[model samples]
Target: MNKLLAGKRLLITGAARGLGLDFAQAACAAGAQVVMADILDELVEQEAGALVEQGFDAVAVRLDLADPESIKAVAAFSAARFGEVDGLVNCGAIATGIGGPDMCELEIDTWDRVMTVNVRGTWLMSRAMVPHLAASTAGKIVNIASDTALWGAPRLMAYVASKGAVISMSRSMARELGAQNICVNTVCPGLTLVEATAYVPRERHEHYINGRAIQREQMPEDVTGSVLYLLSDLASFVTGQTLAVNGGFVCN
Candidate 1:
């Protein structure tokens, strides 16, 4: 209600579309300056331009999460352009479809690729930006996780493993960065209808709907509010916690 992100300079990776884009829009609407980075260079630029035209503080930059040098360059760029980063949403990830081999057929290379983007990417991005974030009064890192880690979903072994690592890394980050006043948290998304989930079998989607207590599919927008909360002063005392955003897919 107080435009919780006002005056906050934030960066959201994998923000060309889907949840990342949704979160960026929400953050911008709340009066924060947003930098949307993604691997899809053209889409990111287009989306960023559109947001800019709409009077939002947004910019799209090319970022290959798997490349460490690329990660550092963008961090430097953001710091130079924004002066400081108040928050970060580590939303960049490689869904299993990209190179995911099935559980039994999954290759070691596939595992490395998934881990490279999902786990290593989050860590590298946070490490690169933490210094700039430390300069802010409400420095925060919100890592996007998955319900697979919570429920141990089958056939997605690599993805589940990577997300599990993200959860563990988030906890360690919380312990280490708390002294710097940076709150690190993980948001585990359920079977949300994002483009990345398009490859999922219909049966799997229905399985979620049938099993969920809410009995409804989650939209990308459904997760944005919680993400905003994590980035705001309201969550100042909350850290090292994994908040599930699924529709009762794996409720505690």
Candidate 2:
């Protein structure tokens, strides 16, 4: 295991599967004691157990980003488990099968749900972790966003709008948390091949494959490196930035 994040304690939201799960595993492999939180308690526990069996330090905790109480609880749990947590990766959002609706046709409930979890939840989660993060000498926050927001992908109005809000939110968060040494940034990945994106159309997949500088399907691995960097000490001075991690599908 790499010691890049040795002695650090990190919390990853939406760690049941897909990018969140990948992030949790990667963080553990990087030598960080991780709190893997997600709404799917059993599954997250299983993932954490798998990591522990591999000699990685990790624990599973239930987290519902849409619930303010749940957000508060997770923060407290992390702090209680590992005082002065080193980093937070806000990967929990309502992204699964949330496309195929134009702006005008998108349902208000759908928009609200997306915003509640993606935008508002992120804001609240970051807010809740501020104190614990402040307790650390080096603190970091990485908000997971989507490249679809950058290029204004069609039929994904609510999701795109929600992610755009997250991108904008990270800037403000960085400004506010700068005084305390907490680096806040957003990473926008292109359509990644994950459980959350399995509903994407085949033509759309080919479209992404053809339009990228790398000309390949984006994977969880492709996005994790940037996030891990933002979490590590190497990026201590880097904050309030949006990194487009898509294969140049939407350059930033």
Candidate 3:
């Protein structure tokens, strides 16, 4: 059977581990040349090398979402390696845990950091990649969001706010880039049990599981299918949309 992303080059940010790593692997399995980028340079390199050993066309690049220069550098690196970037998965984000305070107790610095990486960073990365994506016959962009944004989860004001911004920005980007034949969309996954979410309280995890229609733990793989569809020709006309991959947690 022919692969869905044959001959395509895709870049996935925050790909050192967890959901980002899963995205890279899925994209590779679907026949796209994957560039796994993350701030964790060592880990990203190792992950990419492992995929290469597995006979997949994959590479790694260091990316600091908070820094525009780093974003630009990674974009250039990816293009040099693959000639053009056909798709982008913006999976890099800063979440609550380090300092996720309630709205009344939220720190300004925490909010700034979350916004810088989650919102501004996604925009900057897309900005740098738009030209390359425009060059592709099937250009696509998928921004990873959280279901918390849809449900308005409490206490994680910064994270929720940043993700909300991402959802809104995706719509505008889709409209703007539609003229270039580039499809842009957001995928909002429920509370997934990825390494980055290990700090979540057990009760909170149970809450999400119980609330979900599937009544099971949501994993990184559960979200990959939606992303894969979005990046494929199957979704060429499915732009400016937000698909919730949370097992019916947020039906829209």
Question: TM-score for every candidate vs. truth?
Answer: 0.96, 0.98, 0.97
Residue 149 displacement in candidate 1 (angstroms): 0.6
On residues 78-152, what C-alpha lDDT tens digit does candidate 1 reach at each position? Answer: 898799899999999986762246688988888899999999999999999989999886799999999889998
Candidate 2 Cα outliers beyond 4 Å, as residue runs: 96-99
lDDT of 1 at 35: 87
Question: Which residue segments of model 3 deviate by more than 4 Å?
Answer: 98-100
Candidate 2 lDDT, tens digit per residue, 1-252?
467888889999999999999999888888899999999999999999999999999999999989999999999999999988999999998863544757788789988899999999999999999999999978999999988889988888888889999999999999999999999999998889999888888999999899999998898999888888999999999999999998988778
Name the better of 1 and 3 by lDDT.
3
State the lDDT of candidate 3 residue by residue for 154-246, as single tens digits.
899999999999999999999999999999999999988889988988888888888888999998889988999999989999999999999
- Model 1 bad stretches (over 4 Å): 98-101
Query: How many clashes (backbone atoms < 3 Å, residues ≥3 apart in a chain or on different chains) does model 2 have?
Result: 0
User: What is the Å distance of residue 76 in model 1 from its true position?
Assistant: 0.8
| Error at 236, model 3, angstroms | 0.7
For all candidates in order, the CA lDDT equals 0.91, 0.91, 0.92
> Clashing residue pairs, candidate 2?
none
